[model samples]
Target: MTESDHRAKLFGTDGIRGIANMEPMTVETCVRLGRSAAHVFKDGTHRHRILIGKDTRLSGYMLENALVAGICSMGVDVLLVGPLPTPGIAYVTRSLRADAGIVISASHNSYQDNGIKFFSRDGFKLGDDTEHEIEQLTFTGRIDDIRPTASEVGKATRIDDAGARYIEHVKRSFPNGMTLEGMKIVVDCAHGAAYKVGPWVFKELGAQTINIGVEPNGRNINVGVGSLHPEVAA
Candidate 1:
């Protein structure tokens, strides 16, 4: 499908997302979520690390930084994979042997919408207990107890080239000789994380590609395009 032909999906049960800096997905809420996550993960462990990844939402840069700040205040290190698919973070968390993995994205949502999801050390979503604990921390403002020392403060580092690696992995799922050379495809990335690589993959496979929803303004995501709103795709 051409990028312009895609539609956006809506918010599911797991997280809150909407136009960037608006409604449920504002930067303020993201900061709070970060703090909440830090509190939930703090277990008196002197050493802690969190692996964070995001899709192409324009708001991703803001949210990722806010989340890292929140996590670091509680003394957890953050490793950032600038732009990656949701599943890629899950795999990297297990591979890198980190304490946790966080994804800042609204999968298939438009560029305006964004969200946060976490995975534990075991490579699964955070359990109810952990999520509840974080929620309580967010509401109660009782984070002082979990604060880290100056020396223990966490740092943020970016892992570039993550998208390339992810693309290679995704291509492996197809048949060895399958190619889309003669196909005409339209792709709508919702101007989010998949903006670059999504189209790249189709072109590499030799498809004649048309792209839309690939430009994010931090406010147009999921507004009129993406997987949720299939009208565009149709």
Candidate 2:
């Protein structure tokens, strides 16, 4: 009945998560889950559109494609904002008036781990029944049965400016009277999604910024850096 209830039944304390390429995070599971989400949101009142975003993980590409394929099969259009921060997806989902939003991330996990989280049209999370329903639909093999008409086939489009858009918005959060004209800062980006933008923000604020851990080899995310292991910065 409530999103929390739905989450408790279908998702973990977080979202559906596991090691990358394993269990719930597998490509097959992502596809099935995407199809189920589309099915749950089908309505005659409006064209169904879903916004999907992901953090920078090596497996992100694989999961993104799988999810798009599955959701599209159910006639749900997908707007992809690749390699965005998790909160960025939440912001864009509500701003764009999409039917739903999904994120692929493990949120501070190592690169070998990943997860899937869902948000509602109102920019909240999905409920337990909703999550369970999707999981059931996925596991029951009912996903393939739901097909869109030629006119209804969903389209996938990339939102290339999401990062810049987020940056512009974040800049406004700084104190109006605050300026970083003479600060020297060392920024370690964990080689994750923030590799580019994190350092840029420091520079933009007029800080003498030194950036490290900005290189992601697909295997180095959170290996020895990031918020999870701040000791790496020392």
In candidate 2 the C-alpha lDDT for residue 131 amounts to 78
Query: Where in model 2 is the C-alpha error above 4 Å?
Result: 1-10, 141-144
Model 1 clash tally, residue pairs: 26
Please report the candidate that would top TM-score against the real structure.
2
Top candidate when judged by lDDT against the true structure: 2
lDDT of each: 0.73, 0.81
Q: Report the C-alpha lDDT of model 1 over 1-234, residue by residue, as the tens digit.
A: 321221122123564466677644556656777777766676664677889998766678888888888888777788888766677788777767778888888776555567778889766887766776665666465774676777887888787867776677678787888899899999987766677778988888789988987876666766678777778876
Provide the clashing-pair count of each candidate structure. Answer: 26, 5
Candidate 1 Cα outliers beyond 4 Å, as residue runs: 1-12, 18-29, 42-46, 56-58, 107-113, 228-234
Candidate 1 overall Cα lDDT vs. reference?
0.73
In angstroms, what RMSD does candidate 2 have relative to the true structure?
Answer: 4.0
lDDT by residue (28-61, candidate 2, tens digit) is 7788888888998876768789999987788988
